[model samples]
Target chain A: MPDPALPRRVRVHEVGPRDGLQNEAAVLPVEIKAEFIHRLAGAGLDTVEATSFVHPRWVPQLADAERLYPMVADLVDRGVRLPVLVPNARGLDRALGLGVREIAVFAAVTESFARANLNRTVAESLALFEPVVARARAEGLRVRGYLSMCFGDFEEGPVDPARVVGVCRRLEDMGCSELSLGDTIGTATPGHVARLLTDLHAAGIGPDRLAVHFHDTYGQALANTLTALRHGVTTVDASAGGLGGCPYARSATGNLATEDLLWMLDGLGIETGVDLRRLAATSDWMAEHLGRPGPSRALRALTHRDTPTPQDKEP
Target chain B: MPDPALPRRVRVHEVGPRDGLQNEAAVLPVEIKAEFIHRLAGAGLDTVEATSFVHPRWVPQLADAERLYPMVADLVDRGVRLPVLVPNARGLDRALGLGVREIAVFAAVTESFARANLNRTVAESLALFEPVVARARAEGLRVRGYLSMCFGDFEEGPVDPARVVGVCRRLEDMGCSELSLGDTIGTATPGHVARLLTDLHAAGIGPDRLAVHFHDTYGQALANTLTALRHGVTTVDASAGGLGGCPYARSATGNLATEDLLWMLDGLGIETGVDLRRLAATSDWMAEHLGRPGPSRALRALTHRDTPTPQDKEP
Candidate 1:
């Protein structure tokens, strides 16, 4: 009998071009960011979050979103998923006008992260996103609701799991096709993950409606991913080269690296449909461009050609 | 009720002083090496591999083993376990003469690694160690037998599990206190570990008589460790600051970092009695001396002072 906790296949949401670059210190040219997105899609990622439509004045790093949207429109037309973050109805309108077929709305479980990140409280942010989710879905665009700080906030030691479940359930009820639970601080362990998922399940949300987004801050990203996979979570969000960071936690690292996640997925015999070698090479290029090796160990090893191919295939 | 696959507590074998340092390119001063061992023992690691007795002609990095022994001799008398690597009868004599109560022997499951590393065929290497093992035990020393390339070899991929089981059983029958299965190339995955441990269990060997060693070459070490823990294996081998290298795969990173393993163990609430923060500090110091940051993400984040202490406990 198949294990109840493990899934047969997983969907990888590539967030390198958007979430990764947003948290990076050095901003890349529009052309380079465009190329990075294409490279990730070419690496066989089905879903690639292209960019956020938050006001350019607020996020100058993604100022080229208007120009960037046209560059990857071909992939969008080809049915390759390109999700853009929409903070409110205004952002949703901007995305829909660009012929975008998928939009993601962001909210935080804690008032502190919400106020600091979005300049609104949790209730205020969710209320703002309600119309955005409705408008995006009404326009025939699939909407994904992001629940950041689901595990814990930086200032808050541990956010109550009941509050997390309430926030997630509200998102689902508000027409979010999926809710990506964010471990913003990377402090959540396997036990925390298991417990949170169990509580969520008890709160009438199943793994089928959930995706896990974890940061590698404390080095538990992959282990947490493994636990999530065992609990039937088939969708994972990762950044190429582990790009991005938490504003509150200065020393905290980036999102789980795509290559690191792929290593474990490939090892578990679970299909991700993403080409490991190509994704690793792309991260390597981005790391070199950044002037430092990013946090992904697989990228470091693969780029160095340290991995041993089978003798039958070796020269 | 507790889960059947997981263990309550685990024993972490700190090989940073011996295995970790030997693979490093920069040879540290003998005093630094001695102090590193003491620091590891001070961090609550009861078993710290102090050094190796291999010919100085072969491992000039550890050429100061003779001088190193006397430095930490106080820990040995204080009931802190210090196991040193003894590669041969001559090496065993050197360790025994130092009044070492514990020693380790090396063997390879595959002939290529055995031949390339020890200059002997697998059978010949095992034959050569029979007397050494006998002599070590005769002197009342606890001997650990390491079977490397158990998962696969550099030149030959996928060593037979039966062969590994046979080698381990022979070592056990020869009176070795424990057998550590080494994934020398670090190509091992959770499934590989599960299958190997399953076969080993069928051979009548449980976790008590076995320890698992892994290299983080592909970034699957911690995930693999979780799998091993589920199978009731309680002993894990780790290196501080993620020091060391594979003789076969140079670009392949070192053994699993102790901090990385500690993150999972602490998360799982599995007791190891080792202080995570203290160990991370020592690795930080060692990494600074090495002129590079070590691979442990926990060390990177902790040393960055990013972790939040609980408010009720914060000073």
Candidate 2:
């Protein structure tokens, strides 16, 4: 029998190639980015976020999306799924022209964050994305809606759960296939996450159509994920080597590390089909090119697993 | 009213001074170690692991335990708990000579780890600790037993849970006031942690007499801590700035950071009585002295909470 304590299989949506590198300080070459995506797929990640179609002025790092998509577009036949981020109707059109099958849109639960991040009010931003989501859905693209600051906004200590529920309903009503509830500040504890998910479930957004995107800002991401999982949420968004940047908590690490997520899943006998060693090696390769350490604890341990006998410090 | 989901108050056993520094590659001066301990206690960590009584040759980093103890001994009046590690009869004698009221003994759960870490068989190591635990209790000292590799051993993937239970019973029987079950390799997940705690409860070692010492090697420490808390565990071990080295996972980060733990406890409405900002400041100070970054994500966030708008990297 499957373990009742955990989901039988978790769908780990790998956001490294796009989400990870987008927040990084150094702008890696487009070749490295494509190779990173290929390595992630080779590591058995079923879904890898390829790139975002935001204007280059907004995110110059991911500006090569036009050239980057074709390099790995053939992977669809190999049973790998690539989801690209489309910020607006123009972006969605670009993705559609590239024949993208899945796309994601983002929104903040708080007006302050919404204004700061999107230069529009929450209502205005939602109105702006309504057509984008409709057009993307009409184009047969599976859309994932990222509800950032759902747990707590960076400007406000917490956005009301009812408000988050409202946003989730709006996004779902706009034809999004899934909603990734993000604790944008990573200040959420298990109790907070559990309460939010419980409220969302009561609001008719059950685990089946929901995912959790948590930052490690306060180091609560994994714990929050476990809480969400206990509430039957199976989809989790993680970045390889824990890439990504949090404009809210800039000094903080970004998304929960995929390797860290897989470690818990592996120990619980939950299947994700992601080869951890290969993922760690890919992350290690990326870290070398990034010229700094990745925030992933598991990646570091696994990468250094074969080091010589350790005796200089106490275990 | 306290949240039913978490304990009302958690006794954070700060292990940074001893466990954290001992694993670090760069050894700070004894005065810095002493100051760090003072700062931890100043930050309101009631239980601080001051130092170890092991021989200098074995743990040269803590060689000044004798001198260090006297510097912070005054904290006893301030309602702080300082427990010093004693490896054997000689170590206990050294601790006793200094009028130490709290002392700890360590024994590995696996023969392989026992040999590699202590250069003794599991049975032999326990045999050697028999006199030490006895004499410490006889001297009116509260003894803590560290059951290393209780969850999983580095050499042997995992030891039998029954074997861990037997060791726990023996340590309790030998007058160890508390048994700190350790995931020495930091590989334990929530499921594994829950299962072991269940078995330990079945074996008559309830949460009342148990604590958990987990490394963040795989980024599972806090999640494991949350699971332990949900299972009624109230005492959690953490090092400030997530210091310490895993002689096992040398590249792995140290114990769960106190700031990270407090962040959860604070959010869950659990009382820790520790100031998060001061703890973060102390960790930041220590990090600067160490000439490397601290691994505590919360400390990093709090340390950089006031930095100018972050557009340099992704979160």
Candidate 3:
């Protein structure tokens, strides 16, 4: 049983539709991506990150978001929140044109990753996102700010907890509804997460105003998520099929698989309202479309054990 | 800086040499396995699990343990503890014949997994290992008992924490030096872990007598490990390059990646004597040999960042 005083079910933001597929080599059909988003929404995810409005040259895989977003407009009619990633003023402009209600901006904690991955320095990237946030607020759009490499970075090594707190404060002050701290390189341990969260909490960042995005790069994402939940964080980010990886980092897998996340949450008696079996099917669907084995270890295990025969390898 | 009460370092039992390669499809050469063990020892791990004495049919990967064990014996002379896995009486007999000093035995908490994976029910498996423990004690060999599926299982679903405690107590009664609780399917969350540890502690299972074995299946292994560590459980089981996976459940990746574990411990100022660089190199070596990428997300990130040019492929 859950403590009545504590939040029983955290809000999980499904990022596979956007962040998960955007990094893949395979360019999924717009219909397939739309179906995945619809299925994820049907599975009861609080927020489905639909697509990124970045330049095609940067992330070619998601170049079809223009058509993809409108295809899932029925979700919006049903009152489901669909947030899209807006990298800059241009991305925000495009997302706004698509009638996006919620927008997300991402920056890194370290300058190296900011420059390498996002093509901007920490200060420069945050500066670029400020006006976008302002425009979104004026347009009655909800804005979310994400600070990547909050725990550690691939290029610069261990991240200072204070640096994360500083970034969070900035994002919060910038009119972002929620600030997400990401262990971008998947280098965090529970102790590191606890220490960082505690420090941030002491710095006056309330858990309700915070979210955590963990990669299964090192298989510590869910453990890190649990640590955040204990601290009263209500929002988490997960990818379906665990389908995203850092293009800059080798051997990095993807984010915490949503089905696996739902599995653990279900077992804990927490109410996420997500269907594990349905999510597993969606993962299998994407795995087949991608022409690669799905990155989710948990979904594969469930399918293998539950399926009477192993012949259904196709989507 | 570390807490004054914190030990500068913790012992990392590198189970990859034994636990990892045991489930691998391609059998490594005996010299390669020996070199792998030697490198782990040189990397400052206080204990490196070297080999198992299970029948070759049970685990063909480590069939050359006869030649591999004696080859790495000098590490013990240098104060490294080499622990071997013994399935039952016959396995123990063979290990004792090799002059084994330390051994480990495991039982599953779920009846279905116990019967399917271990060829016995929970009670019967426990009974089968009791005589082996007695013989190990008589022969002056240290014994450690592992309780698998401590969190939950694929077939049996959620397992009772009380049952885990009962098994731990039974193993202690059989003269086992330590009891390791394994979240075999990686379904445990931190709350689940804390509650289980608290219940076990209240049941008189002291921290000193407890060890933790975690799989990164659901990306919660390290967080669960930290929960156990905070409860004063010291010894941890990890695999190099995060090499192992459940043969029964392929998507359940192996134990927590050693690099990810060490990186967190390093950041927290907890001394885990394992050299992060050497450990990373060892993972890279193994990955190269296997024609697969290393299992660790953190190691891969660090290795990629350090390389002169970015890696074109996943490996």
Instruction: Choose the strongest candidate by lDDT.
Output: 2
lDDT per residue (tens digit) for residues B70-152 in model 1: 99999988889999999998998888888999999999899888888888998999889999999999999999999998886
Clashes of each: 2, 6, 4
- Model 2 CA deviation exceeding 4 Å by range: A1-3, A247-249, A305-315, B1-5, B25-27, B305-315
Expressed as tens digits, the lDDT of each residue in A1-315 for candidate 1 is 223457889999988888888876677888888888898988999999999998987777787888899998899777789999987777777887888888899889988888888888889888888888877778888889888887756687667788899999889888999899998878777777877888899988999999999998777788789888888899999998788866555555689988888877776677888888899888888877778887777777667754564311111
Tens digits of per-residue lDDT, candidate 3, A1-315, equal 453433688788888988788778768789988998888887777689998898988888899989999999889989889999998899888998989999999878888888887788888888888888999999999998988877666566668888888888778778999888887777676667777778888999888888899877655677678767777887888888787866665455688888767766765567787877788888887788888867776677666754331211000
* Candidate 3 chain A TM-score vs. reference chain A: 0.93
Arranged by DockQ, best first: 1, 2, 3
| Worst 10-residue lDDT window, candidate 1 chain B | B306-315
Q: After superposition, how far is residue A223 of candidate 2 from its true place, in Å?
A: 1.0
After superposing all C-alphas onto the true structure, candidate 1 shows an RMSD in angstroms of 2.8
Is model 1 an incorrect, acceptable, medium or high docking prediction? Answer: acceptable
Question: What DockQ does each listed candidate score?
Answer: 0.44, 0.42, 0.27
Report the C-alpha lDDT of model 3 over B1-315, residue by residue, as the tens digit: 344433455778789988788778898899999999888888888888899898998899988878888898888788889999999899898888887789999888878878878888899999999999999999999998988878766666667788898999899999999888887766676667777888889999987888888887666677667767777777888899888866765356668889878866775667687778888888898888888986676677657754431211101
Point out where model 3 deviates above 4 Å. Answer: A1-6, A113-125, A161-163, A246-253, A305-315, B1-9, B117-121, B245-253, B302-315
DockQ-superior candidate, 2 or 3: 2
DockQ agreement of candidate 3 with the native complex:
0.27
Reference-based lDDT, residue B46, model 3: 80
Q: Is model 3 an incorrect, acceptable, medium or high docking prediction? A: acceptable
Candidate 3 pairs with clashing backbones: A223-B220, B8-B271, B9-B271, B10-B271
